[model samples]
Target chain A: MKITAPISTPAEVEPLVRAGARELYCGVVPPDWIQRFNTSGVNRRVFGNLNGYADLERVVEKAHALDADVFLVLNAQQYGEQHLDALTEIGARFRSIGGNAAIVADISLIASLAANVPDLAIHVSSVATCRNVESARFFAGLGASRIILPRDVTVAEISAITTELPELEIEAFVLNDGCVFEEGTCHTVHLPMNKGGPICIDNYQFEYQSAGGGQPHERALRRLEQNDLDYKRWLWYRFGNGFSVAPNGYPWGPCGTCAMPAMHAAGVHSVKIAGREGASERKIKSVELVAQVLRRIEAGESEEKVREFAVGLRGAPGHCASGYMCYYPEVRSRAVVGEVEAKVEVPA
Target chain B: MTIPQSTPTLPAPPGPIELGFALVDERELAAFARHDRLTRDDYLDQLGDARDCVSLPENAEPTHFFLGSEFCEHLLPSVESIDRAVALCERWGLTFGLVTPIACDGLFEPLRAALARLPAGSEVTINDWGVARLVQREFPDLRPVAGRLLGKMLKDPRLPSATWARMYPNGLRAGPFREILDGLGIGRLELDFPPFGAADMYAGIDFPVGVRAPYGYIAKGRICKLGSLSLDTPEKFSPGHKCRRECLGFSEVGARPGTHELHTSQRGNTMYYRHAAGMATAVAEAVANGWVSRIVLSGA
Candidate 1:
């Protein structure tokens, strides 16, 4: 499987590629985009954006010299109609830099990049939430070359999509950036979190209130002062359903390298190591580790041996510890979804 | 009795727009009735406190109805429930919309076929792109509305309090995003009414948008509360294990640990948030200025 790693500046491309990155992805926020659209820009990440076209151009050149592909990210989940003009300019600059693809989440942007920049391959970001075969097909129909599956899907689901849509490249998570909730559909507002507030980590201290019968004093509904606030909220926290708080703090960036064998069998094209905002050393270590596992697995190592070795790389993603950080969490824990009942015929 | 040839259409009167409600199943509908069953004035006063109340006005003649789960197929309604929803909506002359969760390999065909059999022009809110494609390819007659789940707007109620300001889409040019959705035949955008950010700003966006009200939907999980509550072990409360569907019995609610405000509630697999003081006005302003075209109220 191709290992796609994040690069920060032009300097990161060579080392990452030599460190065993087959594909490189990066983003840029020009002066205009900053002045006009003051948010995080099209990159979704507040940090890790390339300073300008020159930096991006340098990264593409270095990566191309190593015969590696570079992808520019426009994967922000939301986009404004006013920014389309800027989006076009960004798309043009990315293509001019010899970037191989555009990783995108917004449907309009995917359509935009595909049509306006015809040659650039379209890779749907995990935020697009292609959790099902039909969703993958939807993106494929829109001319997407590859789709990065969400962090929450099962290996079996990945297997199904790869087998069903062989023409399209399917990528899944291998190392880092695990979300407590499914990424594509989550709306927890990460960037400007309150003091310890990004709900994913369960940091925000919450007050429980009764939602039934329109309780006049929701807060006064006898909180009972339970020691385990998490447990109490599980039973009584009724709204649409339940909250997804990252366990053990923000280390939700759990690795999934152990699933390499399954991903290979499933025909997943790439294994992603997240953290565009993370350190280059960390990125390189992740690439080297996953590459070691992939090389061994490819070189006729037993699946058992590889899984054991994968764990040796990091204690995370080992066996199903039922930890909140693990992606494809079912790989270790009894998945918290799929509640469909067994259909059995009862003899009358 | 004169049987009407066509179902009565629910157009917004010259006053406020007609509001609708979303329920996961009959149990939620019943839950809603228990609250609405109280004195109208009393219920209105306590609307924000109701377990399933989505900030809907009591005078709301819910002309449109979304009846199903939008995050997990495990939470998806049974066939019997679908039929019941159709009947209830038809009886009340409400536009029936089936809420679909994430697209699963096994559930797509069956869900598509089931939805196709509904009344022509029925609305189907889609969270997965594959399902969006399914509606375009197989059920063109059904209106495919991209609900808030699919919008993925990052909004947190605690944000404006702790930080300077969160970024929101202010406007857009006639860029590729609009043309692409247009090509796919998707004309509407459903948005979450975030706590502090834009509900949103799809300015120059040439499509009608809808908002999930008072309790704007925040995050969704593969973990489910229905089955979770049954187990004494929180870790054991996971997906795919045996479930009595316990979410039907009770829901969990809480406020931020140190503060009584920024409250969150869990119903099934989705989390809903009640906005802090005065933030509702900002969300309302977004809706008023056409950032959001309608308010979508649903049970988790």
Candidate 2:
């Protein structure tokens, strides 16, 4: 499997590529588009985008020199007519600059680019919500060469898609940045941090009003309180414990390193490191983490050993044990069972 | 009231407007029956009791019924329930429609089984492209309508309608999307009444448009907060986990004090906001002018 890392500047290209990223992706928000549409540009990010075509060209050139492919992100769920025209122009310019692919979500844009700019390989973004094999096939028919599976999809679903469509390249998320909502179907805007930030992460005080006519019993009320607590805890984990970093410098967030062996066996061609708008150091560390795990898998290490090594690198055994940081929690079930078996085999 | 002499009147479109009801279960039928009698504010602010019954106005009675869900596959009704809904619709002489959610691989078979239960020529609201492709390839007889979930718009409740309308005036209208919809045999496009007016956005579209009233969805996710309520901490917020359908009992309403007046309600995995009282005027005007073909009333 290959590691596809996010890079914004030409400088980030070399460090990310040297850190073991085989493919690089970034968003370019030109001044014109930003002026016309504000920071809610063609991509989901509000920051860390290359400001001009010249910068993007340099990014592509540098990555290509390092024997790595570069993809420009135009992956908004839907774009207006003006936005579409500008994006199509951007796609043509990227192709002219020798960019390898365009990661996109809108079907119209996908079909348009496939027909107009046939040379540019299209990678369907996870925001397209390709959870099923049929969705994968649909995008493939529309000329997408790669499908980035959404983060919420199970390992079994990923296996099913890879198994059904062996010809299409499949990418799965490995580390950092998990959304509480399905990114594709969510219509709420993520305004700038100055403008109260993403709606999903907004701290709103909740009041549970019963739909039933009569008042609920005390036990039922206690259950509802517990439900509220559980919901808040889940949100906290989903937001990466308010984006805290570990003492070992690894980011604490939704991770899928334990599922790497399963994903590799399932024919996932690449693993994606999310957070393109994040700092370059974090991006490099994420790529390094995935690269290390992939190297062990390549060396034919057992899945259990790889899981242990991945947990060790992440540096939070408690979070791993709780399965709160897992993108695929199913792996934890297997790991727990394995531990139980090993304990049983040991002499008392 | 003094009439504004400067207001330009547009000619009403020829043909009758169709009214429809979108219900999650039989329990919602009671609320929907009194839909026409309740004002927009009354419906938005005071409809807490699900069992409350009120009378419907004769002229405003619905002629169609849309069953099932557009967000959660787990919330999909059984095949028997679908058949019963269709039978009830038949008895009431109302047209029956099916709303399918953005489904995963596991839901494909069950959705197909449900689709098979529908009679020929029934309208099926498709929220996912995969579901659209599946219906087009398999159930050729059923007509597909692009659902509101598929219609991507700027739907922040905190923002004014004018801002959202200006930002996303034309949704799913650019590129070859209309042609693609045609290729899929979609006859109509379904949209929610945005806080902003719908007339400008609904204009110049090729197919007929259907608008859902009052509750406009802001966001949705696969990991349902209500479903997570019953699970332990380790399994909390896990996507596709089994649930007790806690959302059917109550919804969590939220407000950000000292920020915005927009209140959000979390029903199941989806977050929705009630549109302003005057927001429907533009949609009503659009309906009068032939831009909007139908108005669907949903009780959350």
Candidate 3:
């Protein structure tokens, strides 16, 4: 699997490419666009984009020099009619800057780009939420050359989609910013980080109530309920503990140096490392660490060795006990349940 | 007398537009069908049928039928299911719309097959652009409604305290986004009313809108918690073997004092907000402003 790293600045280009990234993707929020629509143009980055277009052009040019391709992200959920002209211009600039493709979320924008900027490859952002094969085929047919699968799907689902739609390239997240909710459909807005960002992960006012109710309702609960909760027992099992208990798997942490073998076997075209707004050190480390693991996997190292390496690199061993921080929760779950030393093949 | 001249009596505000409820399984549909009004008791039972949406309510005929899944692409009903829903809705003179989720690949052929069976002017809510393109191309007669997912409404659940009040009162939509929706051949758009207020945010967007009930869905997962929630060991409730349609049973979980709420419950392998709510007047006012045309009365 090829490593698809995030690039925000020209400085990140060389080190990331040298680290392991064969492909890089970046977002460009030009000042004019920002001044106009007041966002990175519907991007996932509500804090604002990491780089400007001129900087993006420099990043792309440098990545190209290193034989790595750069994609321009314009993957906001909506790009209004007024933004379309500016959007078309952005696409033109990216292509002119030698950006490999443009990752888009809106269908209208996808249609617009495909029609107006035929030369620029159009990739459907995971924000489009293309979960199934038909969805993949629909976008591939509609002109999106690639589908970046959402973080919620398992390796098996990814394999199924890639298997069915082999013509379109499939990319899946392998590192950074793991989501509790499926990204595209999640409507909860994040407050500015200083205000309390990474919102929804640890927000307050939410509560779950007992399912018990009226006589007939009570009767049905006794008869049909299998996973009923104990409201009286306040031992953390009440209305909805899915978030509080599991905390939605992991935070915007790492998922590097693991799941390589399964990802390769699953036939994923690319594995993305998500952190365009990351610190330079964090960004470089993520790319380098994934690259090291890839090298080991390429050398046919055991899954145990690769995992051990990753755990140490992620600093999970003696220091951390939170398995929720696991990169591949399936593998982690299997490791605990099956009592194996974490070298087994992940479920596909 | 001139000022009081009957104030041009505005057409009685269209009688709240016949709010339609969405069900996850046949049991809820049956309850809706059997009862004149779903009791609080009936609603509690309906919550248990988490992983599966109701097959057409053979008895209870909603004004507009949303006959499909919204979150899980895998849970999409068979083409046969769509065919049956379309036929039944047609017989009832009810408008049948396939409530599509944000999915692309696995649903194409099934949707197409179902569309072939649908009469002209049938609606397929487009949550994914790929679905939109397919509906535009192969299934020309089937109308596409830009789904709420496409609208990208900024939803922030409000707290009781005034500390966070400043974070909200935000607004969405403008001339350009509305034009884009129109460009997509979307005469209608599905909307989810936010916590604080939405009557004004959605004011100028002129497309006929279908507003989902008081509760807006915040976050959901592919592996539904209700689908595999184990009573014995909660930790074991990972996305294991999908439940045998036992999600009908609902449970309540909450934090003490000041806890930020994110209620989730599974409905046939997909999850919706378990405690989503909004005021009736907000929706009524939306209808008054022509911002709403249909009401998707969802699970409370």
The candidate scoring highest on DockQ is 2
Q: State how far residue A79 of model 1 sits from its true place (Å).
A: 1.6
lDDT, candidate 3, A1-348, per-residue tens: 789988767888898888889998887777786577655534667542545767876787788889998888888655555677788798988898787999987766777788788999998898777777766776775588899987656666777887877788999877766655566766555656544454343433323333343223565445334333321111121111221212222222435345676777778888888877767766777777678778887788877777666555633342112223434455553342233332211111
Docking class of 3: acceptable
Candidates 1 and 2, the one with greater DockQ: 2
- Which candidate comes out best when scored by TM-score? 2
lDDT of 1 at A95: 84
- Ten consecutive residues with minimal summed lDDT in candidate 1 chain B? B1-10
TM-score rank order: 2, 1, 3
Docking class of 1: acceptable
Q: Is candidate 1 or 3 superior in DockQ?
A: 1
Instruction: Give the residue spans of candidate 2 off by over 4 A.
Output: A35-40, A213-216, A333-348, B1-13, B26-60, B160-170
Quote the lDDT for B233 in model 1. Answer: 43
- Cα lDDT of all candidates, in order? 0.65, 0.77, 0.59
Query: Of models 1 and 3, which has the larger lDDT?
Result: 1
Model 3 lDDT per residue over B25-111, tens place: 433343344454332224323334321221111122256666665665545556666666666556655677777776534456666
lDDT of 1: 0.65
Error of 2 at A58 (Å): 1.3
